[model samples]
Target: MSKAVIEFTDFSFTYRAQQEPTLRGINLSIREGEKVLIVGPSGSGKSTLAHCINGLIPFYYPGETAGSLRIMGQEQQEQSIAALSQTVGTVLQDPDGQFVGLTVGEDIAFVLENAAVPLQEMKERVTAAARAAGIGDLLSASPQELSGGQKQKTMLAGVLAGNVDILLFDEPLASLDPFTGTRTIEHIDRLQRETGKTVIIIEHRLEEVLHRPVDRIIIMNDGVIACDLPPAELLSSGLLAGTGLREPLYLTALRYAGVAVTPDLQPQHPELIRLEGAAQRLEQWVDGYREQSGPAEAVPLLELKEVTFGYERETAVLDKLSLTVNRGEMLAIAGRNGAGKSTVSKLICGFYKPSSGSIWLNGRDIGRDTIKERAERIGFVMQNPNHMLSKTLLYDEVAFGLKLRDVPEELIRERVHGVLRICGLHAFREWPISALSYGQKKRVTIASILVLEPEIIILDEPTAGQDYRHYNEMMEFLRGLSSRGITVIMITHDMHLMLEYAQRAIVLADGKKAGDDRPERILTDRSIVEKANLRETSLYTLALRAGLQQPEELVRTFIAFDREVRRR
Candidate 1:
């Protein structure tokens, strides 16, 4: 038997701010050299459990934690998160949140420096860690300049530099592009192969790690271990439904469709349910499309003409890319990290002047106006709310743009308050911006831009750090704006969002257009999904893999079939 690296015995914890304990009745043992994936919905005590592993529960969080958590055979309370660092290295959900150094090289060195390694040996360790994390080429670059994936890998490299016995990652892929996120997990898999260190990852997207060999799958709910089993038996036990976690999308789709799992079938081994329920549900959703005769408006609101953009040497992030956006169109740009997807958004918003090509907004050359003019015409909400936030209070922050435009107090009040309600921030109107959680703050930043009431609104990664319920609310709100005749262009890594919300998807690869098609078309295209490193919706994957080759048609069928099932 392998040695137990960490163990929790009947542990439960309550955060300082909450009346109820976030986690309750948790019991588990982790083995050295083992890789385990922990999953649960948001606020399910998964994070709390992870914090306990490294003693963050009491040290960083002044909370009441009952029961016992042991790290390296020492009680968790005895070891500070700092002291526990030698035994276990932890990376947070956000890479930027954990970054300690301004430059990549300096960050890696800092981890080793704390280990009190010799300067010569430290350099060797840093180099090896950086190489292992695949950030060697970016050693000298500013940490801020690296893409989301690169930033994460840099942090991973820092974690590995200490050469700890156990590594803990908290939703490491939360902020990364799907492609980069998958690659990051793959890199971690490689590290496990080479170093033989125990790894515990807290992840939301199960599909990314599903194919990777893991020692155990631990599901958490209401702060306790709901199920602990090998992958083969995990699903058949009805554990997923009880926990309310989305199973592998494909599996969920199949289960909903009423397909039976055979005795010989292995749940963990890429098994697909036969397409009975799937085809029914899929066809229903597809048939709804026929109900829509045309776009909400008649004329194109934004048009791109042979857009070619890049640095010297004729490099094109947007290679002769041409696209049309009608009033009320919500167009999502998607591709692998570092693909020219964001470049096209920057070009449209006037963040970058295209090397060649012209952009027309409302039948006028957008090139004719300055960025400020472009801002007035189109509002850009960046991925990070902190990046866009400027004011102390939530109300002021939302009103800043309108006030700058010299709008009157009466108008601003009506606009700002209305935005606050829609964005779900009216209650916190007087609170400091710093007081808001990450998701609320993001919505606030978006509300600020929305108040500007630009004809065109562009949001990058709008759904990051959001729950499914909030995701629905935000999209429903965006759909309302589209109904009011605003053009929305989104740059996103969320395939589900692209699948359900977006009317059109523009894919980029190597600084050029890969495909410009309806999202349903793009979502199921095996080549595009592979090349773009897109997360195929479980629904679509199950339908296709289950002998229902046509996903769009299946989606249509499923909607109708689901309603019928509900009705019966």
Candidate 2:
């Protein structure tokens, strides 16, 4: 057996700013060359454990510590971050924030250059690492010009160039499209096998990470280790759901069908899981299930006619695209990165005017409307909360929009508090923005928009950093808003979110409308799914594996059933 590369004994940590320890008594060990996944709900100490391993706890965070943490058999506190980087290479959650060079090659070489490696050696290492990361062709490309997947590869290459023994990825799939996320997992698995390195991933996307094999999964909750077991064992434990984390969708389907999920059945991977009576059980479930009716005929509320837009004149980000959003409709815009998903929201919010198209809002051309004028009817919650957040306190942030519109102070307080409570932020209303976690900040941004109560709300990647419990709460709130005649438009990469909440899905590929239909139809169609860089939901796969005649209908039925269960 390989020796332990990382070990913690009675470990605990408390940030200097906090009275309580973020992590408590974490006694764990990760062997050399092990591939481990750490997952939990938000504020579950998963990030704190990761920071401890990567030397961020003491070196950067300045936390009070207890007990021992050893990386590569060396005491963690004795080593500086620079020294730790030589053994543990960390790829942060946001790749854009990590970029320090103009081109991919230069960025990858930055680490080696910092260590004062020879120029020729640095160049060779950078090229080799880029090739290994499958981004050799993107060496000359600027980080801004690459797709999300490509940018992730660039970040991987930068870490690879460091030649570290352990690679730590922090929420690597958070911003990626479904297809890209699957590919990234494949790459990580391949890198681990080829390099014989220890791989540690901190992520909430458990099912996505389980796309490839992992040796074990470590579940953290409330500042301590909750469960540690192999993937198959963990899946069979029925602990994930109880801990407020989502189990794999296929497993959920299996349980719904009354199938016993056991470790012996190999339940970790959807394709390989053994299901003895799944076909019959699922068939009976489908027979008993009633499908929900489609949305009522939509009265067009917004329209884009031959919208052609580009940052530069020569290349259009959105090319001659056209679509309509119905009033009070819950619409989802989905595509791979760089397919102009966010750009569409920006255009509607009047951030950028279409180069040659008319934007019609309620039968009137709003191309001449200023951004402030658009804000009266349109509320946009951006993907990055940092970009939209300006207030220091949560309450102040949520109330900022209402204050600007000269709403009465008392009414603003009432509205802001209500929205904050709806968004699960009422408890943290007095907290500073910097003190909150990323997921909390996301809610703050959403609350800021919700307080305005605009006619139409546009949320970009609304649930990216959120856990399952909070995601459900937020989506339920949005569903209530939709029921009350507020139009909701979501630009998201979460396949589950798209299937569950979106009434209609608009798929764009190469900046063109590839498909427009119900979410289940868009997801079940192989061509559209691939073209839009999406994965068919595991529920769809489960249906096919169960030998169902109409897999698409099964997908739809499952979603309806799931929604009903959540509603209850």
Candidate 3:
């Protein structure tokens, strides 16, 4: 048996700025060469635990520590941050914040350069790390110029070059497409196997992280360890259902089909699991399922005609793209990173003008509208809340837009309070923005826009980095907005979110529309899914493995059933 490299006994931590303890009475051990996943809802103390391990708990985030904690059998308080960093290397959630060097190679070699390693040795180590990370060709490219996935790879190579025994990834899949997330998990698995290093991943996307094998999963809830077990055991125990973490889609499908999931069946991998009579049960469920009526014929509210745009004169980001969005519709814009998903949203918001075409809104040309003018009718919420929030208090932040419009003080107060309640932020109205979690901050930004009461709202990756409960809450709120005749456009890479919430999906690839259809159809179509860097959901894989003749139909039926269940 491998020795425990990380151990905690009766551990607890309280930040200097907080009154209550963030991590409480935690007892845990992680063995060397083990790959483990830690997950929980926001403010569940998972991040605090990670900070403790990476020497940031006391060194960076000044905090009070209690009980005992050890790294590699040595007391944690005895080591400096720089010394702990040599043994533990972390890849942050936002890779952009970690970049220091101009080029990929320089970034990877930054640590070695600081250590005064020989020039030849640094080059050899950097090259080897880049090749291992599958970014050898990008050595000369600027880190800022790379795609989301490429930036993550560069961060991984930089950590790998440090030759740390333990690797930690913080929300590694938050910014990646479904296909790229799977590939990243595969790469992490390969590295752990080849190097015999301990791996720890802290993420909310449970399904994506389970793509590769894991030794165990640790569930954190309210400043304590809730459960710790192996993958198969944990899935079979049904503990995840109440923890606000989503089970793998295929496993959920099995339950929906009346199949009892057991550990002996190996529930971790859908393709390998054995489900006796599952096919017949699923078929019966589908046969008994009645399809809901489609929406009334769409009334075009916004249209783009042969729009062409390019950041550089020689290279086009969007090429003669044309599409129409219906009034009171919920639309999903999806594609791989750097595939012009956000560019389309920007063009609609009047941030950039098309080079050769026009945009029409409600039968009127919007080509000459200023960005401020467009903001009155079209609201855009960025992926990062930090970029949008300016006020210190939550109430002030939400009221900023209304105040800017010279609304009466009484009217602004009523509108701000109403929007806050809808966003589930009324309780924290007077709290400082810095005290809120990442998910809560995101809601504040949305509330700021909701006060404006725009006709159409565009959210870029709204559910990214959020737990299952928070994700459901946000989508349900958006669904309510759509029911009231508000149009919503979400730029996303989450296939499951697209399947669950999006009424129509527009797929972009190489600056052109690749497919426009219902989310289930878009996800199941092999050619379109592959071309747009999306993988078929595991539910589809379950159908194919069961030899179902109509896999797409099964996917559609399952989505309908899942939505109905959630509605209750």
Using all chains and alpha carbons, the TM-scores for the candidates as numbered come to 0.82, 0.98, 0.98
Model 2, span 1-568: residue lDDT tens: 8999999999999999889999999999999999999999988999888888898879888979999999999999999999999999988778898999999999999999999999989989999999999999889999988888898899999999999999999999988999999999999999999989999999989999999999999999999999999999999998998899999888887887788899999998879987676789988888898866656778999999999999998999999999999988899999998899999999999999999988999999999999999999999999988899998988998888888889999999899888888888888889889988778899999989988889999999998899998898899999899888899999999998999999999999998999999999999999999898999999898888889999888888878889888888
For each candidate in the order shown, give its overall lDDT on alpha carbons: 0.77, 0.92, 0.91
Runs off by more than 4 Å, candidate 2? 292-294
RMSD of each: 4.3, 1.2, 1.3
Tens digits of lDDT, candidate 1, 62-159:
77888888888888787667788878888877778777777898988886777678999988888999999998888889988888888888888888
| Candidate 3 TM-score, C-alpha based | 0.98
Candidate 1 stretches with Cα past 4 Å from truth are: 9-28, 43-45, 55-67, 97-105, 135-145, 213-245, 260-265, 268-298, 311-316, 393-396, 399-432, 435-437, 451-453, 530-544, 548-568
Ranking by lDDT: 2, 3, 1
Query: By descending TM-score, how would the candidates be arranged?
Result: 2, 3, 1
Clashes of 1: 24
Worst 10 residues of 1 by lDDT: 558-567
Error of 3 at 551 (Å): 0.6
Residues 9-91, candidate 3, lDDT per residue (tens digit)? 99999999888999999999999999999999877899889999999879988989999999998999999988888889999
In model 2, the Cα lDDT at residue 532 comes to 86
